[model samples]
Target: MAMDGKARSAKAALKRQAMKEVELRHTVRYGIKQMLGDLMHWNKISEMGEALQLLILNAVPESALLYRNADIPLMPAEMIRHHARQGIQDRLDDLAGQMFGASHKHVIELLILCAHDAGPEGSAKHLRIPRHEITINENVSRKLDQARIREELRMGRDD
Candidate 1:
């Protein structure tokens, strides 16, 4: 009985010491710390990133810039949990790294761009942004045409 009591007190002391260390670590305001936390916390960030990526991919132009930039497909939560068990977590951080270093501003910009492009393209109806009239200069238009022709020629050669 005495030994058990001693062991319990030792364990309690160790836990308190560890918690003190955690408190000290969090005292410094580090920028954008995405390291692994508890499972629920990690899942929350992962789900948000995955959900945004899914929504962006589903909306507009199909070949829009956001769709292109949102290259990583979101996996089901069960699959993510399974992968986490295997030490392959942090899909959210990976998604952020791919999406211009995980800057929320960039993600919002892409979403806004999608909204602007999709308004007329008829992919997303509810979202609307003021369509800015873009005038392509003659030089830019010619260069774009040349690139299109070169791509066609390459495709023909491939065939």
Candidate 2:
């Protein structure tokens, strides 16, 4: 009976470990999707800030940072010193590369520039060529607002 109980305990432990891995995978996937939207300034991205905050905080792992910064004009040394932290950098370079492609660095640079730019409405532009005009659909905006409210309510209940 003890041996059977031990087997059940081990099985339960494995199940918990698997659940944790699944959750991690889901979070990573969701983060990447949101990051892509943030970079592109597309679809519900305006409501999210995690990716931008990570960049602003310079808190992405070093591997992802180096990958994101590849082949781009270096940020001013002062900006780098002020923005980035010195610590153990990880080796997740492939994550940025795979998710962002070759222009990842340039995109990040443009984002930083936009953040610092203090100009009148028409003074600056996003980094994309053949500049497409951005228009928010009112219907979509209403739906997003409703969704946000529902999410807040759900979160309140969970808490």
Candidate 3:
């Protein structure tokens, strides 16, 4: 009987140790998942900002020139600020569709700053910027054409 009691106590101790290990594993996995989530969120925001900047630079050569020259006047700055605010608002509205959580607001703000411009195109109606004006840079125009071709190829592949 004494031996049996000792064996039972040992079995219970082993079970407790197993439970503790399982808990530790779960905690570690949770931490890793959270870190990955944050990293992915940051990457998405960075990519969006890059794409937006490319769009803005390609859309408004005058604004891009001002930025490149670091000679943006007060009027241009105000217009850029207004566009940035609008971009933020648009991002917020589309957040739910993008499956982004609360932390994404900061990311959107960062993207807005990188993509803001204040040229004639900025004042134009949405989606109304002339393709000729938007494609002022020959290199950017070639790249845009290539991208369109690639997109078309992808769509064809899907079919």
> Residues 69-140, candidate 3, lDDT per residue (tens digit)?
233232311111112234434444454234334233223322232234322334222112235534368888
Per-residue CA lDDT of candidate 1, range 1-159, in tens? 356888997896687565442111111112112211221142343443333333333433333344445433233211111111111123333444656474433333344344433443442332322266999999999999999999999999999
Q: Scored by CA lDDT, what does every candidate get? A: 0.39, 0.39, 0.37
Error of 1 at 17 (Å): 28
Provide the global lDDT of candidate 1 against the true structure.
0.39
Ranking by TM-score: 1, 2, 3
Window of ten residues with lowest summed lDDT in model 3: 21-30
- Go through the candidates in order and give the clash count of each: 0, 0, 0
TM-score of each: 0.22, 0.20, 0.17
Ranked by lDDT, the better of candidates 2 and 3 is 2
Tell me, by TM-score, which candidate is best. 1
> Which of the two candidates, 1 or 3, achieves a greater TM-score against the reference?
1
TM-score, structure 1 vs. true: 0.22
* Candidate 2 Cα errors over 4 Å, as ranges: 1-128
